[model samples]
Target: MDKLEGKLHKLEFYISLLLQMVDDTKYPFFKLVIENQLSEEEVTEVIELCKQTEIDFYVQKEQGWVIYEDLLAQFVGQLNSKLPVNQVIKSLYDQEMYSELMGEFLSIIAKHN
Candidate 1:
């Protein structure tokens, strides 16, 4: 099932990307589970789990460098919400701060995994 496989791929991709952000941020551990035979419903459930586990950590921004702990916490909170994937992504992408950090984190994730 391409549709289901695609969703899994997307979830895996997002989990990996989010993990990358978490690794660099203050919250060392966050709830991120990668499922093999996941339906859309299950993926959303995992997202909700992640949201509740999100912690508000401090961050500092200086020049071109940003601490990103606060941004990562916000990202996790958004990630775990019950919102539709497209809607959640749209909101996240619209916010330039998270969007840019996500891009960098995704790039870093690609290299590592």
Candidate 2:
């Protein structure tokens, strides 16, 4: 795969994983996919936005691209929960799942390349 193709695939895989991690019904991030209305252009735009912001977890919502931190905060706020997005991310890192996930992602990229 070429560089752009690899990046697109990575973004798609990341978004798919995000969908699995969150409650799609409650998150606007998954709306496009769930409603079968997602477009390639939008996906590309989302990827570009993430690259520009240096944040890999941006999601394409109806209003536009939203960072994962904001999405998680909104979700937690709505639920009146004490668990913040940073804490969740820190927990993942503390458990080493983040590293495992990154390793898997790199392996997948290598296989594609």
Q: Report every candidate's CA lDDT.
A: 0.45, 0.43
Tens digit per residue, CA lDDT, model 2, 4-84 = 999999988887786677753344333333334446665455435424333333223334653244433333344212223
Give stretches of model 2 more than 4 Å off: 28-35, 39-113
Best by TM-score: 2
lDDT of 1 by residue, 31-104 (tens): 22222334567666654543332222122333344454445445545553433433333333343324554454
What C-alpha lDDT, on a 0 to 100 scale, does residue 15 get in candidate 1?
Answer: 80
Decoy 1 TM-score against native: 0.25
- Angstrom error at residue 70, model 2: 39
TM-score of each: 0.25, 0.27
